[model samples]
Target: MSFKVAIIGRPNVGKSTLFNRLAGRKLALVDDTPGVTRDRRSHAAKLYDLHFEVIDTAGFEDAAPSTLQGRMRAQTEIAIQEADLIFFMVDAKAGLLPDDTTFAGIVRKSGKPVVLIANKAEARGAQGGMLEAWELGLGEPVPFSAEHGVGLPDLRDAVVEALGADRVFGEEDEDDGEIAASDVLIGEDIADPDAEEVPAYDENKPMRIAVVGRPNAGKSTMINALIGEERLLTGPEAGITRDSISVDWQWRGRPMKLFDTAGMRRKSRVQEKLERMSVQDGLHAVRFAEIVIIVLDATIPFEKQDLQIADLIIREGRAPVIAFNKWDLIDHPQAVLAELREKTERLLPQVRGIQAVPVSAETGRGLDKLMEAVVRTHRVWNSRVSTGKLNRWLETILAHHPPPAVAGRRLKIKYLTQAKTRPPGFVVSCSRPDAVPQSYVRYLTNSLREAFDMPGVPIRMALRTSDNPFAGRAKKRT
Candidate 1:
């Protein structure tokens, strides 16, 4: 089992920054504003050679029950209770406040190993604050700068000692040996698509899928129904989910990692600091996911925001499966389904023939079909076509609809070859590539989609003028 560490402190203590530092990327949103984080976010973190699950929690606050801050505080308590070790952080620049001392006592009461961290230690003025941190009774505070990376080694050593060297680094695991700093994997390492070829779907690697929609769109309920348990908190309230929570499960024996994100509202509507952070976090999930399921409420399908979200997914190059939730609540299912399909075709012409599955996330209806669509779209998104087959297909299409003349000369189309596929990027070599009209490019894109059976996934095509080796030399000589 991997070690679990929770970073707990008051608002603006740089806990999120430290969490990002340990994770080796900016997974958490960092801002100068206090109380920016509301819910607990966890990721598989690597600190040097140590691999552990690190959780970034909301700032600790003393608030009355039934308040929003109270709920946030409860979430932080859950993280603290579940963690094996706690990094009780405090702002060295701000010094020890009464809230820090109060929370430190709470952390001590949990009986988990505690490592006091004095962040912002890079400032010369913070020395007095670091000295004052000893009174918390946790232990000698590890003076460190989460922003400047001044004392990461000391912090890592402190964590190792707190969790024990053997526990942090398994003794008998031969393959999981200590890795060099250069060998550390960042968050983008798993996200960066393979360059030239579409990666085969591996059963071992869990397919990351994010389910997102507007508020009260039944996103969490849908996830609960799929997992066959109420693993997420759901109610009649809008904007319930504040964090992008990931749940790991097996779908038809295939490993899957599902992310349930906060409801996304219009930019103008997102005025609060906390909600803005939540939306940003949700967007991050979409970028990281391989397939994005845009959940829509069947009664009010294809709203302006729904279309906008779909557009965002296509622009991000993630395979999208449009799902209509609350189908059970809709009247005249046949007509509604027909209209939804027509609207999808008209509004989202960019991803023609996109998969639109109607399901009742509440009653668990049409779930199998949704999963099937997800798998199929994911396969197509990673599809690649050989150069010979692509060129052959291009020849047939070109014969049917020849390129239009531009500036008194017909564009000479030579060859077409697929350069890569995550979204199936292609390169077309021809004469006067710049003269090719966008309408012709669109026709080729549509034809390629139809010919290859690649629907709902983005396809990239680039026009390149064929090179003449001796043209530059001849020009120079002349």
Candidate 2:
């Protein structure tokens, strides 16, 4: 059985740095700013021969139960309850502070095994702080440095002794093996016209969905409601989440992974470096996710930033589902829903027929409809159309509205063929690709969307010059 360990400490105690060291990857964002980590992030960790799960939690602080810091402390308490061991870390160079002493007593109340780690021991004057760490009454402090990999073996030994050597070094866990075929998605230039169609929803592989929007838009609240647990920190304060947290969840017995990303604002308005990093991380999640749920506040829906986020999702070729959040505050549900639908079609014509579900994350309303829309959108995103059917539709479209004349030579539009799926893309061969007007291309795109019943997903069409080697070469005098 795998052991669970929780890293608890005051703000800026290098808990996240140690977490990255144990995880052997930079999964958590580290910065000089205190309280950078606000959520409890867990990952499979390995220390030498010992392998187990480690959780990184927000720093412990003394605040009211209703304050943001208090909510953060509550999350840390949850982590403590779930962990088999606790790593109460402290700064050896800076020594212990009042907050450290106060929280140490609290952690002592828990019956779980505790390992006191004194980080930053490499510094010249750290010996004095290490001496001070002994007063916390947890145990002997293990002098270590998370930045330079100091005292790792001693730390590992303490853990082994605490959890027992047999359980600490158990049988090796099995590997997850190769990625499922359904996970092979997203690349440019689909050369094979006859490649097998994308498989239907593979329930075994977890679907990745990212929830993103502006600050104070209830992104975390929505995710917490879906998981039916306060898995993340939520408060009245804006920008409570700093890291891109991913949670593995299930709905209707289908495995799913939800990513809660930091809120994004306009470039001009985002002045702080940390907020910029958070926004960039959110964008990365949007690009990697299969479907992006753009949450818009119902009180002020369709703001410029909201439209920009939706457009960005489309440009990334990821399926998008808009959630009209804060619906509980809306006075007229039916009228608001109709108005929002109209605004969606008018504002985001690129992905026509997009589903905008009015949802109240505060209450448990419209959640079922929201998920149904998500599953349906995923189906459309991965769909493919046969080449023959595409060519037939292309011929009919061309016969109705022929390409306009450029330099007195009408463009000869050849047959159409699908290049790829996962946000379906197509290739249209024509006589002069450069001469095709942007308006004409938009027409073909709309026509394809309507003909194939593709809606709410970005559709790409590349105009390539018809492949004719002989025609390009000098015509022989015959």
Candidate 3:
């Protein structure tokens, strides 16, 4: 079994800060599920070559045993039970409160080796709490300022001592041995640890897919249906999701990291910091995603924020696919789909070739088609075209359509080359580059997208006047 280390403490005690410090990446997908982490956040963590699984759990509060807070408390307790060692963190500046006494008793009884961590200890003011941590009866406290990057070596040593030198590697446990950090965490995850190590079929890493749109748009239902489990908190609440939560899984043998974000609305009435932060966090998910699935309510598909979100994704350089979710709820499905397409074509011309997959996320109606689009778009994003073939294609297209006349002059379209891919962009050299008409540019772009069978991927073409290859030749004038 992989060794597990759980960090437990009250809220705002730097537990998350310490977690981020050790994990070295803020990969946590924060959402509506407050403390008592909705899912076990595990990552490979190492100390001086000793690799193990580090679990950042929700903190426990000393509240009545039957409330929602108590249930959250139970979740943390479960983490404590599973941990090989428990780092009972405390706010060094807050000193010891009655609640700390209540929680200390709970941790003391677990019998698992407890490492008392004094976070925010950089301030001399924390001396009182540093001393108070000793009173928890978990032996000498290991003072650590998780934010200031203080006392890491000592902390590592404390871990070794508690876990034992033999247990440092999982060999001491049974059926497991020296592990790399990723090995430990990825093992418990849904995706194969080998999928990451092995030569997977796809070159692209798990594409970050975000399901976003207005509230009650079946975003959660779609994700649950996709994963075949109720992983997110779904309800009738308009904005049930307060934070973005990501689940790692595989689809058709391709590893994927999917994020389900809170429904985004306009900021006209948003008045709270916590709410604003939640919205911003959701947008951040969209910004990080490779393909954002804008889940729209079938009844009222595209709203102001929906268009805004789609525009933002394009601006962020991420491919977008629209899922008109709750298709079953629509009266005239085909007509509505057609209308939506026409509207999207007009309002969002910048994202020229985006796919609009009409399906009910509730019934798993069109997921296969959705996946097909995602894979197809991703392939387009990673596609590379040879220069020789590209120039040949360009020659045929230019001859067929021809550049439009600029004033009395017939503009000449010259050689072409692809500058980038991932949306497969191209640069075309021409005479009087700026003289190329907008209609001609659109025609060329549409032709490229259609010819390449690149349905949903963004295609970019730029015109530049080429410098004469012999411009630098010395004059032979007498």
Each candidate structure's TM-score, on Cα atoms with residue i matched to residue i, is 0.79, 0.94, 0.78
- Tell me the whole-model lDDT of each prediction, alpha carbons only: 0.85, 0.89, 0.73
Ranking by TM-score: 2, 1, 3
- In terms of lDDT, model 1 sits at 0.85
Candidate of highest TM-score: 2
Per-residue accuracy of model 3 over 185-225 as CA lDDT, tens digit each: 10011122112232223654566687888777878778878
lDDT of 1 by residue, 1-478 (tens): 3688999999999998988887777767788888867767787677777778889988999997567677778889989998999999999999999999999999999999999999999897999999999999999999999898888889889988898888888742323221231231112122333233435665454578899999999998899899997566676778878778877789999888898999999988999887888898898888878889999999988889998999898888788899999999987999989988999999999999899999998889999999999998988877777677778898998899999999899898899877666577888888988889999999999999999899988887889987788775744554
What residue pairs clash in candidate 2, if any at all? none
Off by over 4 Å in 3: 26-40, 61-83, 98-113, 134-139, 170-206, 214-221, 229-245, 267-288, 326-342, 358-365, 470-478
Backbone-clash count (model 3): 1
Ranking by lDDT: 2, 1, 3
- lDDT score of residue 377 within candidate 3: 75
Clashes of 1: 0
RMSD vs true structure, all candidates: 5.3, 2.4, 7.1
